[model samples]
Target chain A: MDNIAGHKSSLTWAVHISVALLVLLWLLPTLGLLVSSFRTADQIAGSGWWAAPFPQEESLQLRTAGPDEMTQDGDLYVIEGNLLEQNGAGDLDISAWGTSARDVSAYAPGKTAEMRGGETMTLEEDGTYRLTSAEAFEGRGERVFVSATVPPEFTLDNYERILFSDDSREGMAKAFFNTLTVTIPATIIPILIAAFAAYALAWMDFPGRALLVAAVVALLVVPLQLALIPLLRLHLSIGIGKGYMGVWLAHTAFGMPLAVYLLRNYMVGLPKDIIENAKVDGATDFQIFTRIVLPLSFPALASFAIFQFLWTWNDLLVALVFLIDASGQTTVMTRQIVELLGTRGGNWEILATAAFVSISVPLVVFFAMQRYLVRGLLAGSVK
Target chain B: MNPALQGVIIVVLAVAVCVGYFWSSNQILDRVIFPAKGEKAGQNINRANMVRPWLFLFPALLVLGVYLAYPVVETLRLSLTQRVGSGYEFVGFDNYVQMWNEPKFREALLNNMLWLVVVPAASTAFGLLAAQLTDRIGWGAVAKSLIFMPMAISFVGAAVIWKLVYDARPLGQDQIGILNAIYLGLGGDAPQTWLTIPFWNNFFLMAVLVWIQTGFAMVILSAALRGIPEETVEAAIVDGAGPLRVFFQIKVPQIMGTILVVWTTITVIVLKIFDIVYAMTNGQFETQVLANYMYDKLFRANDWGVGSAGAMVIMLLVTPILVWNVYNARKEMR
Candidate 1:
């Protein structure tokens, strides 16, 4: 689209800026979740994820070491500690400090606050604090409030808790495995089934082949909500029941139309010369399909596999209906994330981590096989 | 056995069985049932060819019919019948009547209409914009993939992502949600809980769909735009058509068919959009769409009659597209 007139149209910069903005808009949400998953619960609640890379300025409440650590020095009992050092936020720089909640941040760092019991507490910007009194400090210690700017922190603890937790109910490991269990068979079986059907429709001389193809196209847009009740009843009555078998069958059935549609579309485009030459060589239709056409239709098959994998893996409704039971044993990642959303709505650490775990596989597949995905989209929508 | 090990074994076994079924059936037809050798060898071969396509198509056809085709009819039947004790009695139109009377269903229908209008149009417009703009830039493919990235993320995942965007905290606290922070930053009096606000929240929900689907629209429309006749575009520009004029008048008109395809494709997606509504709002706060409504009737309320009726409504809405598609396929066949 470069200007042949060589006038250097001003629209180019406008286009560049617009695309930059669009890319950022598209990337920010997932970026936020990815950042949040590496943060702790307190960090998420304290500030928005957009501030993740910057230093966090927060107010902290800390206590000096107990009266047991006190010593008499020149007619005074004293306790000394660094609030930031004790809390392990040694990177933090205190901006303000105070001795009571009512007067939080009443003084700048290094100022001393006079207590009612004739005790004096002095805090410095480096978080070092001194507690001195004529009598030894009582109970715990003098409470001090510090408003400080702490350096950014990130952690792998969220992943550890979600993936390696002892309780199966809390961890994502089982659901992750269950999702894989549903996805792999659902992907592979449909390709073989759809490929054979596609080969038949594409090359075979048969009555009603066109009608079957049209029916597949019609079935392409049939919303699966209509399949819910009837299929559930079928599952229960036939004793397929809500588990791995039932969900796999449901996924296969649901994925069949597009599988056949995409594969047949690609297969039909396969040159007539090859199939006819194979037939002329005395190869069976089965041989022609498996030997020549199956290998030839790799792109279409790959496209469908990725589609079925993502659909069956990310599926919540189908899993909810046919796979997941009241026992929560057959739960998949999507279902687990939804459950987290319900029970741990405010727990962004868990929600973000589980959501990320659920989406990460699809994202990996998506980026890796994106070419096939896009090609499938273009081919599938051609008609 | 450990559950993971059990899952792995089942996966292995299932794959083996499916493969075995395909291979053994074809092997049986060839080796045992109709071996292409005999006194009537040609006859056997001819018979074998006739039976073989069905063998190829049988598994897929069986699944399509039993899983997809039967459900359309069965769901239709359930809609007209009321459940009795261990049986169903035919009561035509009663279920539809009950479903129609519910305020929630009405709200759902209204909201689905809103979605149908907004999501496809907004997605298409933005997609066209992205497609056109990116082509004029050097880093278009990189930008397009980033836009298309959301298509891979599940709807539940998207709901979680957007929930954070629409998240709100009370005033006088550091607002955690991006929208809230922006709202407060822009000097809005209070942070709006975007999802809970009525009348406008639907747009917030729709924005998530828009954000996700714009990539799809962009990808399809970008291809369509690339497929445009360069000569025609050149001729348009030769006549002093401005850039916008060339776009709206020339480029868009040529790709109108693809645009319609993108629109209809997204329309189908919008109709079946369940996870977003289910996860974010659960159809509360006047955000009920028909799919969620049907789910509510079937699962939560345990009303099969009305649930089936709701399903039929969605089916009815889709019938026109099905007919159009079948008609198109038949036309293409001829």
Candidate 2:
């Protein structure tokens, strides 16, 4: 008995440790991007995001105040200031300093380096500096290379540039609104259409109802890839062309199968006695559907709404074919991010910030109403 | 006009129109067309009930027919015909012959097969593992939520997130990309540009999907696992089965049906995957999947014949699942 109990306790510990490891592995990639979005471009280039919270030692090249700032003191020309303080490193602790890039930390902080022209320079760990020349300093300020330990810094500048800047190439503000334009109508219209249809399929005794239900089931797995060219041709010929109306219609059509299927399934499960009672009360089919059936199917309605909203918001292929024009005026967030990936592939800061802005809205919806989303998935898939 | 303003106007107008249609149509039917008054009131009520379902079903059926059902037939016809000057000519399998001859098409076919196998399997395994393990611990809901969070992110958004992980820098500078950082830390001689590597880059792209989908599988599978009857597990324990034995031998067998359902659903998703590959590699470096390849042929190459042919190929791959789902649904209905 003791042996069995001992083994059980050990297995419990194993489960905890394994779950922790799995969660971390799953989260690390997204966490990296989330952390990277807040970091400066230089910090991202200098180290990994895992090392973001702690102070990091970095090498910086700074020029002293130009020769115009040099002063005459007791037959020596001198420049006095803090090298780190001058360069936004006021809080940094300098470990070493050098004049050449090859060996950035040749001398300890607070030590003086003898110059070629009978000049000497001293930099202290506290970031203060002194440059003494027997002759007057000339030309640009002397270049000082210093290795300093910098405190962890986070910035919202990347978000500012990506979201607010009017620069056409990097901005996502336009695309964000475009996505909203596509998603809202695309989501609401379908539920309205599908709810009525679903009510009929569930309650109304009509011929070929079984066939129609099967058709919806079959359409559920039909890849929307098949719809692209034909729909585009139809849209162009019908004068809707490639714009918001075309995309909205296409989404509504494509989303109809799932919307109808989920809602019908949920509505079918409603108590049959209520509809019979309503019928006995002389309420017509339309009245029962509008009054009782619609309200009772709220959970199903909410689930399908969340699904359609997320799918439309995240979609790229449909928009690519039906919405965006050559003018690029109707570009959505997903399309904009893809464009950024091609144009600014190496700029992690812009990419991260842009991706996050696009992802944040759906994330909010997902977290706030996760129950409905999960319920929808279960009904949509498990059946 | 501002698109946002246009959106608001459209929403209000759309809601008003829908409400008006349902309300007015129902009113007209009950009051005028088939008034529930006079000597023939019973007959009129029966007639209105008979016609009302069709009225409710009209818009949905019209949209479905034009948008989805017609597209399948039209795309198939377009595949067989060549676009010549402003019109189409029936070329009879020429597009398929040409697509078969193209090496890029073959590469895409092979890569899609690989994606179909790897993504669903990996996602299901990870999801099941997460589902089982998380179910056993305290604070599991938080862990499940974090894992499930990626499903909310769009494919393009996920592409950017993974691109940051797979980022490459020169050897001497500090490596910011997590993958390269780990590779170098483990004594790799130089940082590898993961997405540029030819054959293996496909796996790198598939990782994005697996990351996004595992949460979905975990959510569904976790529910299935919880739904398992506790007495069966207790029975296995009383029989002296170990934890691993109980999991594989007892619990998994019961949930096999749910697992298969999860698998096929993901398989359907995998077959139509586009945004991830389009954003990450754009079918470059032999990473072409069928959907992206079709996009390339249709938009970039301007050859609608081959593009529609490629679309048909996707449809063909999906047909078996569609049939199976319809069959299962019909069976359950019966």
Instruction: Per model, state how many residue pairs clash.
Output: 0, 0
Interface RMSD of candidate 1, in Å, is 1.5
In DockQ terms, which candidate is top? 2
Model 2, A60-81: lDDT tens digits are 8888887878898999989998
Q: For model 1, which pairs clash?
A: none
| Highest-scoring model, lDDT | 2
DockQ of each: 0.72, 0.75
What is the alpha-carbon lDDT for the whole of candidate 2?
0.92
On TM-score, the candidate that comes out on top is 1
TM-score of each prediction:
0.96, 0.96
What ranges in model 2 sit over 4 Å off? A1-6, A73-76, A100-103, A106-121, A132-139, B36-40
Q: After superposition, how far is residue A110 of candidate 2 from its true place, in Å?
A: 4.4
Candidate 1, after superposition: displacement of residue A187 in Å? 1.4
Q: How many Å off is the CA of B178 in candidate 1?
A: 1.8
